[model samples]
Target: MPESATLPSATTKLEYLRKDLEDLRYYLDEFSAFLPLSVIIVNPQGFILDINQAFENLIGLEKAGVLGSTVAKLFCEQEQFAELEARVLKGEVIKGARATLLLRDRQISRSLYLSPRHDCEKNIIGYFLGIYDISENVKLTEGRNGTVCARTIELEEKSEDLLRSRAALMNILEDVAEEQKKVEQERDKTLAIIKNLADGILIFDPHNVLTLINPQAKEMMQLDESSVVGKMAAALTKVTNIMPLINFLGRNIKKVYRKQLELKSDKVLEISAFPFLTGRETLGKMVILHDITREKAIETMKTEFVSVAAHQLRTPLTTVKWSLHLLLHGNLGAITAEQRDLLMRTDEHNERLIGLVNYLLDVARIEQGRFVLRNKNVDFIKLAETVIAPFLEVSKNKQLNFKFIKPREKVLPVNVDEEKMVLVIENLVDNAVNYTPPHGNVTVSLSFDKAKSEVLFTVKDTGIGIPEDNKQRIFTKFYRAENAAMASTSGSGLGLFITKNIIEGHGGRIWFESIQSKGSTFSFTLPLK
Candidate 1:
């Protein structure tokens, strides 16, 4: 190493190194041409040295438009780059930093990173500014125009919970409204039922205020059309402490109470007061007052009739039984075979008469609403087959084709009083078989719809059909069709009436569709579950 060799190459080497450094910086700036982030080079003297294609796009300006301009020229006057330049000169690196820069058309907000570079001698040159468009980010963070990741998830959960709560509340409201409507309807029905009785009804609120008084009550109290409502019961009918006592019974009595109240008309009114309860809420008191004057007379008349009929029936039955016994035992005389046969027929008729009396007694109990049913789950198809077996045998003798078609799906189970349902089916099948003509077909089919949970039992007969005009009256007690009456004058008309009551008790419906001179199809539907 010669001293001359180092000294002669110093100036030339400096020029070459400076040119190489400028070329390297130029290439570095060119490398940013395809970058998505904007690139800007700023000298320590606050001058913009160069910019890339991204910078041109971000500012919406041409490359030549921003050449040789100060960095401050690309920003608002308020956002000058004086402090940023000072920081770069101090050798600080700002990564992922942000700022708002202004252009001709709009203010461009961006995230920027600053990197300061120097030569081998350590003289500060310029800073490389990497900028990302942060308009969407800023809106999401501060401007409130976009959804953030965390906030979006939270809002979604809250919205779901809110929607579920709203649906539940709506269902509750609908259920409550439906229950209220049912209660109102039941109340109206009760009012109508009690008003039809030969009694006076008065309903009072908790405060002893008269809420409702039926027409009978008004008549008994000598009240005009608008006299009783909203007035105290004590004031209206001079029944002191009656309303309060009635309210007390409604709320705290916990039992039905009966008392006698003296009406203004000098009549002793037998009153039965009961509480009106809806769910767990107690509404008020209901008082029913029966005059009992005409009812007492009717009861006396019924008692006299029972005594007389019983005595008359007992004497005849005793005489017939003794006479039949003597004839059967051969105690009276050694009669001929023909005479014995006559005596046996008389005994049979007497026994049938006694059976009729027993049947009438049973019916009387049922008509008075005292009959209790032993409800059980029964296979309806089997039950129907059992009840129709006898009728089918009898129909065979009549040369009527009796067909029982089992349902494809085996048996349908129904909850009902087995004995009562058996009686009903037997009567209906017998009626059909009796009315059907010779060589006619009596078909019974069973079907079920699983979706509706209903079972349909149909009995179709090819016989003389009923008339359309008499259909409604067929179910009435002691009422028989004209054709039926003419055909079977010995039958009691109570069979169909009892059948209807039994079917209704089991929550089933029975109806018949018939065409005159064609046939009749008697169909009944029962609940599956």
Candidate 2:
């Protein structure tokens, strides 16, 4: 009914394909019937399908009469046909084998080639045989007692051609040998890496069939070498802590997933997996299993000590902050201007120290899995407005124009920890405002991405953007970009790190785009319910 629907469909394509196939078969039959050298086509079951005119001439038979006959039953030696069948059907190409064909009244010696034809699935469907007349060259004999005459120049030319061929073949063989040596060396290096590795090695083929298990993996699993290969990797679930094989295969995780797994009683393995990719294919995963019980114990001890120390220092720090605030605000008594300025500076420095301590405590809580979220369904734009207000006043003092683009759909709700979400937005806007120069602008926006089913938050700043070297480590704690360090000296560098943790805890994603000396934009997305 539509103009575009008038084009050819599946039936049209099928008819075109039939026509092409018919033309191809006709051309092939003509070429084979006229060719001088003998050629034979046969089915996998060894029955002859067709033959060339040369083959029919040699055999003194009409091919149309013996189309379904077996080549081994006539026209060739029985022993050789059986040997050829065994070799060719197994996918080996046998070339230049000396075979004698039984002609009408005599035997003809020729060089034979037998090769199997396969379908896309690599199953043998038929065989192709080519016979070359090599009896003239093989029957030639050298002159008796090395004598030569002027009439022997053709034979001398043939000898020289043979010598050149021999030299060329030797060069090819040497090249092949060198290539083989390099391959062998590389193979040995890979095997050494696998066998001597502290972790296990499991290699699966493109078809998801396990093909290799090294000595280290065998030892770790206490498995017999013979039973592992040629099977699926699903067996790992029985003796190791890997997920069920279904989740493990074809998952291009793009990052290393580390897990502390108990393979058996008293056995602890730290497993890390990355989707093993080469060229363009995801192929499979490479998993490393390490014994990290001792490392875990050391980390646990370190975390406990820091937690205890932070709790002890919190009381004194709170007292200092409160005392400084009272003195600066004249709550205790009237103070001289200079004394107030001194107290104000002290209060600012004290706040910086307090922020650092809080960041450290938060990091510890995250590491210990003690950072808990109280999720509530809250209006998303209202949350953004509340956080954006403080940054507006802060930026105005520095002459940076602050902007907040409210979402068109202003009533979207998201389930999140309200306090933690505020921390994320505050850190982003604070960083943007702090980094931008006077008269520069900072913008924050909220929007719903219907395709991803997520609410997007973006912070754009006309600031001295992150340098190339520091961009990779921007989210790492205590890592400040060179430009950022040059522009300001007061930041703790823990904001983005904390922001990343909070966002991921909310099942969100965060990333940024920046160019040095130009500007930067940080974007994050949270799910909208």
Off by over 4 Å in 1: 1-217, 220-224, 227-355
Query: What would the per-residue lDDT of candidate 1 be over residues 352-391, giving only the tens digit for each residue?
Result: 6664554444355455565567888888878887888788
Clashes of 2: 0
Per-residue error for 426 in candidate 2, Å, reads 0.8
RMSD of each: 31.3, 20.6
Minimal lDDT window, size 10, model 2: 245-254
CA lDDT of every candidate: 0.69, 0.75
Largest TM-score belongs to which candidate?
A: 2
- Candidate 2, pairs of clashing residues: none
- Over the stretch 443-499, how does candidate 2's per-residue lDDT look in tens digits? 898899888889999999999998888888999877888878777556878889889
lDDT of 1 at 45: 62
> How many angstroms is residue 103 displaced in model 1 relative to the true structure, after the best TM-score fit?
66
